[model samples]
Target: MTNRIVDHPVLGKLTNRPPVTFTFDGKTYEGMEGDTIASALLANGIRQLRVHEGTGTPRAIYCNIGHCFECRVTVNDAKIVRACMTPIQNEMVIESGKMQPAPFKASPEEWPRTYAEFEKMNDNHKEGVPHA
Candidate 1:
């Protein structure tokens, strides 16, 4: 698809630069050097990147920034990375669906299975160290 950012309301004619091509789920798309992965996908008319793990529903960018995890996608074998924050690189492979088996499994290093556990851990922490 055409990577040229013609005329956007707020962005307003994205600056022309060296074009780079990459694939999203096997479809080629062109984007500028400075565009984030999300921006490039949006420019190429790709809204939904992956399906939700539990619900299997379509999901895409939510906050447009890294604050929300809705835009998570597998990049070059790395899972759960924020797509909006990642810049497109040459030959990068972006895949849909939550990475199977999870990169982190049954590991205390990946704590807080639920938000409540995260909150509890946060409450017990002092100087960024959890109470032992």
Candidate 2:
């Protein structure tokens, strides 16, 4: 995937600054200065930031904000951080994996069909469609 935003209608030429190198899941990529980890990763063509710990589902950036912890990643072998809110530093090491606790846990018997649908709507948002 291409590692730069080109021809954006509102944010034309999104990457104009010098490149900074960072590693994600053992792969090196370049990002512009001041780019958030999520933005840089997406710009670098990485779609999924983590997997659901229980179901092993692919998870990408949702809100692009701190409210949703879906973009969490292990940074520099330190604590897990919200990728959408954290700026990428030169030579930063990033590892992709589930970082937050499950939203809720329940046995299959306890989760009814309607509850499953509700959870799906919640994951994709209540708008009846998941964001691409």
Candidate 3:
């Protein structure tokens, strides 16, 4: 009942890789040794990896290509890694991000943009809008 395709018309058959055991949200699950955490979760029909930081709505893999940070999850209670980019490993503790009551607040420390730099950036976008 997995969504994973074992055989493809172009790639023929995908060899069965060694089984890897891991836990997601405290529930044990099995995945192929080389599968990414996101793929493993999707194969097992466990979507909704985490909630949106701005809105408490549930979110799954949006771009799967690692460009988007929508699939971020905590690993081993310490590191926050993108599930779509992180490979599955044995006994890895994966936890979904907890829901936030309010939207994430951006700070100068995180962005590090000076007021002058911000003004210059804003000025560049002025041409795109019609003036009153």
lDDT of 2: 0.82
- TM-score of candidate 1 versus the correct structure, residues matched by position: 0.66
Per lDDT, the best of the predicted structures is 3
In the order shown, the candidates' Cα RMSDs to the true structure are: 9.9, 12.9, 10.7
Q: Model-by-model lDDT, in order?
A: 0.78, 0.82, 0.83
The most accurate candidate by TM-score is 3
Clashes of each: 0, 0, 0
Candidate 1 stretches with Cα past 4 Å from truth are 1-5, 8-12, 98-132
How many clashes would you count in candidate 3?
0
Report the CA-based lDDT of candidate 3 relative to the real structure.
0.83
Residue 19 displacement in candidate 3 (angstroms): 0.5
Give the Cα RMSD of candidate 1. 9.9
Residues 60-112 of candidate 1 have per-residue lDDT tens digits of: 99998699789888888898878899998877888776534443333666578
TM-score of each: 0.66, 0.68, 0.72
Ranking by lDDT: 3, 2, 1
